[model samples]
Target: MTESYLLGIDVGGTSIKMAIFSNDGDLMEKWSIATNKEKDGEYILEDISVSVKEKWQEMDLQANQFIGAGVGVPGFVDIEHGTIDFAVNIGWRDYPISSILSQHLGLPVVVDNDANLAAAGEYWRGAGVDAEDLILLTLGTGVGGGIIVKGDILHGVAGMAGEIGHVTMIPEAGSPCNCGKSGCLETVASATGMVRMARETIEHNTNSRLYQIWQENGEITTKDIFACAENNDTEAVTIINNAMYYLGLATANIANVLNPEKIVIGGGVSGAGEDLLRPLRFYYDTYALPKVKEHSTFAVAELGNDAGVAGAAWAAKTKAK
Candidate 1:
């Protein structure tokens, strides 16, 4: 009667987060490893494999005690084949990550988009728990999202279902996005977007506190923007309100159609907490249909950084069953 364990791995640009979970969904241990991006990230998987093996041995665990490993990959991945189409940050292109990791660990592996895993994590153990339909928005350097319908992630046919950031928010006179598009949602609703907006504001309105802070610190951060807004700085408040307006409109549009039970907001910008959600909800309520608005709720994500690992574990466990 040996206990079984599930391994969850979240691969990021600079680091990899791994966690071991019990079959019943309890987290046993978690750790981080530096992602070796040398040689086009050729050694990233190898590093993960070696570290996992060492940790397993240190814990005196038998190989047979493990169920499988799940990975939250940071790019377009073909889940059925476990192939990564491209991950610009980590320099992976058309790499067969799933089979490679499976071979190295001698365990079955499941691979999915990192955002999808984040949503799954929230749905299983975080803010979206108990909801059959939900969406998780990660507002980091770039905005990423995941949509869950009926307790399952909605990975579209091209594995590009929940790319909320790339959705065109402004098609005319918008800033250029890294995705080679102009006026994408990522340009306005992400941490980077916040900073960019703040900078633009300071350039135009030299009297704003954000501009004063920028003059003192040489740069402004997302925190400064929210903090200034909290103090009722007109420009900061305007920037935040504008960003939330677009984000809310985008979310409400999705809710109008999908009518998810909940919309969970996560990532670095979400650290602003109520400051972000309050204004976001203001705009959401303005756009969402009356019926959908009443039924759908918005909340901050509770899982934080653990969402990816938790979701990866859920993927492994689900596939094992």
Candidate 2:
């Protein structure tokens, strides 16, 4: 009997990651290639096919050994029709991703939102492994979210279910978000938000250590802010706490609405470790309803970048069955 394999593809704005996994969820091989989304979508698909073929040949395996492929795209997808509705970050719109890839590679393919797949990855094998209901918040350059109920991904009408970042957290204050909304959660809780906060703090509090660091580096990023906070920079701590307040408020709203058993945080900003989680925990405790708060445990994501690939492979396997 031959073992079955699944190919998982995670498409980001700058890179395309591919991973091969055995049916039982063991990672067999993984690699990545540059993604020039400004080019045609078909070109990107062709590059992926070539990479997959190369990997198959290198491993001395035939295409028949693979069950299917799962792709997680950073965009809105019409899952039923397998079309990418739109992805502003990557400049894609209503692209026939599934049909194009399936025809090009001669294999069945499943397409879904990247954040949803990351949440599914966590639910299946990462932080949410113990919880049937889970919500995952990914805080990178932009914020993305995924919601799972009863071990299934929630693709609400238009397949835009887990877009928690765009949810209005503050209606009248703060910087405007790319979503055309003022004070959306992403405006306050994302890495971009953190940088904006740092800029404001530096202008007002020149005596702080963060100002000195910025004076030395000439520019302050979210990572630099986190480093300053670790060194007890008052301004850095203040900015992070401010960001956490919005994150907590957003998490509380999610809990009050979905009441999931677990909430998992991931992406670049989460690297702040205790600095971010401690304050977020405090805010969540202060804001969340008692019933839902008691049931949901907040934690950091364990899978890191591999979550999407692993989740995509798992999704492919599940769909194959």
For every model shown, what is its TM-score relative to the native structure?
0.97, 0.95
Query: Highest lDDT, which number?
Result: 1
Backbone atom clashes (below 3 Å) for every candidate = 0, 0
Report the lDDT of model 2 for residue 70.
89
RMSD of each: 1.2, 1.6
Q: For candidate 2, give the lDDT.
A: 0.87
List of clashing residue pairs for candidate 1: none
lDDT for each of the candidates? 0.92, 0.87
Once fitted onto the true fold, the runs of candidate 2 whose alpha carbons sit more than 4 angstroms away are 1-3
Question: Which digits, one per residue and each the tens of the lDDT, describe model 2 over residues 145-259?
Answer: 9999988889998898999999888788758888787888999899998888888887888988778878998987888988888888778888899999999988998899999
The residue-level lDDT of candidate 1 at 93 comes to: 95
